[model samples]
Target: MSYEFERESLENADDRIVAGRAADGDTVAFAVLVRRYTPMMRAYARRILSGSADVDDVLQDAFITAWEQLAQLQDPGQTKSWLMRITSRKAIDRVRVSRSYTDLTEMELPAPERIAPPRQAEANAGVAALNEALLALPDAQRECWVLREFGGYTYEEIAEQLDVSVSTVRGLLARARKDIIVRMEDWR
Candidate 1:
C-alpha cells in the first residue's frame, strides 16, 4: 500500500489495531495513537498537577515513556487506560520533586479585570475558588479525586495506580469531596 493510503487507513482504524501497529514499530500508527489520546491525557495531567507549569513537560515525558515501552503493553485494546496511568505517574513524580523546593517569595498579583457579564464573573470566581480548594487538598486525596473524577478511573483502577486499597481510595475521595464542599460553601 502507498504511504498515504496506510496513513488514512490507520487514522480510521480501531485503537487496538493502531496500538498493535505502533507496537510493531509503525511510527505513523504511533503518531495516530498520540493524536487520538493527547487531549485527554493533557487534561488528566493538568488536573493531577494542579497549577504546576510543568504539565506539558509531564505529558511529554509520559509519551516518551509510552513510546519506549509500547512493546510491553499486554493488551493493545487497553492503550488509553495505559496512557492515562503513565500520565498520572509522571504528574505525581513532578509533584514529588516540586515539593522539595520552597519558594518563599510572593508572586506579583495580576491586576483585576472585569469579566464581560456579572454572571460570567461569578462563574469564573467559583471556578477559581474550586481550583484553590483543590490545591489546598492533601496530595493523596487530590490524586484520588482527580483520577476518579476527572480521569474517569474506577476506584479499583485508582487503587492500582496509587498502590492503595480500594477502601483507602474511597476514603480519600470522600475526604476530598467534603473539604471541597466546605471550601466552596461561600460561593453557593
Candidate 2:
C-alpha cells in the first residue's frame, strides 16, 4: 500500500523496481538481487571457466563490478541477463589470464531428466570429444567460439570484446564451427 513497501519485501518485487532501488545505493535491494542470481551466475562461470578453481574469484569480481556499475544498467528489468553478461565477461577474463578455457573431459554430469543412464555416458563422451576438438583450435578461434556459444554475446559484442573486426569474428567463428563439426563427425 505504501509508495515503496515492496522494496522491503523483495519476494514479490519486480526486477525493474528492485534493480532501480539497488542502483540508487540500496544495499538490501542489491543483496536480494545477489541472492537471486548467484546460483545461475556460478553455474555459468563454472561452465565457461571449465575445471578452473577461479570460479569464486570470477563471481566475486562480477558481483563487485555489478554493484559499482548497477546505476549504468540501461534496462533495470533485464537484471538477470545483465548479470549473466557481467559474469560471462568476468569468466572470460579469468580464462584469458589463466590461458585455459574448457576441459569438458574432467567435468562431472548430473542425471539426465529424460535420458537413460546409457545416454548420459554417451553425452559425456560427446563432451570429451568436443573438448578435444576445442583444445585443438587456435586461441582466437576458441575464444570466439566460447564467447559466442557460452556467453550468448552478439558478433558485434564479441568483436568489441576481442578487439577484432566483426568480419574477423565471423571468420573465426565460421572456421571454429567447421573444425568442431569435422572433429565431431567421428563421434556422431
Candidate 3:
C-alpha cells in the first residue's frame, strides 16, 4: 500500500483505541489521537488551501470540531475520510471567507521584471491559455478534472468524494478531456 493508505490504516487503529479511552475520560489519550492525525490532516488541508495563508486557522477549527463530534462517529475505520471531509469543508469555507477581504486591485499589478526567452515565454502563454480554458468549464466538470489531475484520485475515489456515481465521474472526465482538446486546437 502507498504511504497514505498505510498511514490511514494506522490512524484508524489508533483512533479506535484513543477514542475509546477518550470516551472514558482520558484526556491524554485524546491528545495522542489528535497528535497522530494532525500531520495527515494538515497535509490534506494544505493541498486544498493551495496558496492560502489561513490554512493553520482552518485546521485548528476543523480539529476542534472533529474532537467535539467524535463520539457520534459510528465507524472508527473511516476516521481518515471523516477528517478529510471536515478539512475540505473548512478549507473551502476559509477561501470563501477570505475572498471578500482580498483586494482585487492588487491582483492587477504588471508582470514581473524578469522575462524568459521567447520559446519559454510562448510555453508559459500556452499554459496560461490552458488554465483559462479550465476556468471556463462548468464547476462540476472542473472539480472532477482537478481531483483526478491534482489529487491523483481514481474515478471511484472521485465519485466517492463528490458523492456521485463512477459512471458520472467517467462522463465528467470524458467531457473535460474533450473540452481541453478543442481548446488546445483553437489555441494552436
Give the candidate number with the greatest TM-score: 2
Tell me, by lDDT, which candidate is best: 2
Rank list by lDDT: 2, 1, 3
Error of 1 at 188 (Å): 3.4
Better-scoring candidate (TM-score), 2 or 3:
2
The TM-scores of all predictions, comma-separated, are 0.79, 0.83, 0.62
Instruction: Sort the predicted structures by TM-score, highest score first.
Output: 2, 1, 3
* Model 3 accuracy (lDDT, Cα): 0.68
Q: Give a tens-digit lDDT track for model 3, residues 21-104.
A: 665665665666677778877766665555356768888998788778888878766776777777766765665565422222
Lowest lDDT 10-residue stretch of candidate 3: 100-109
Which runs of model 2 end up more than 4 angstroms from their true locations? 1-8, 108-123
lDDT of 3 at 152: 69
lDDT of each: 0.82, 0.86, 0.68
Q: Is candidate 2 or candidate 3 better by lDDT?
A: 2
> Which is the better candidate, 1 or 2, if ranked by lDDT?
2
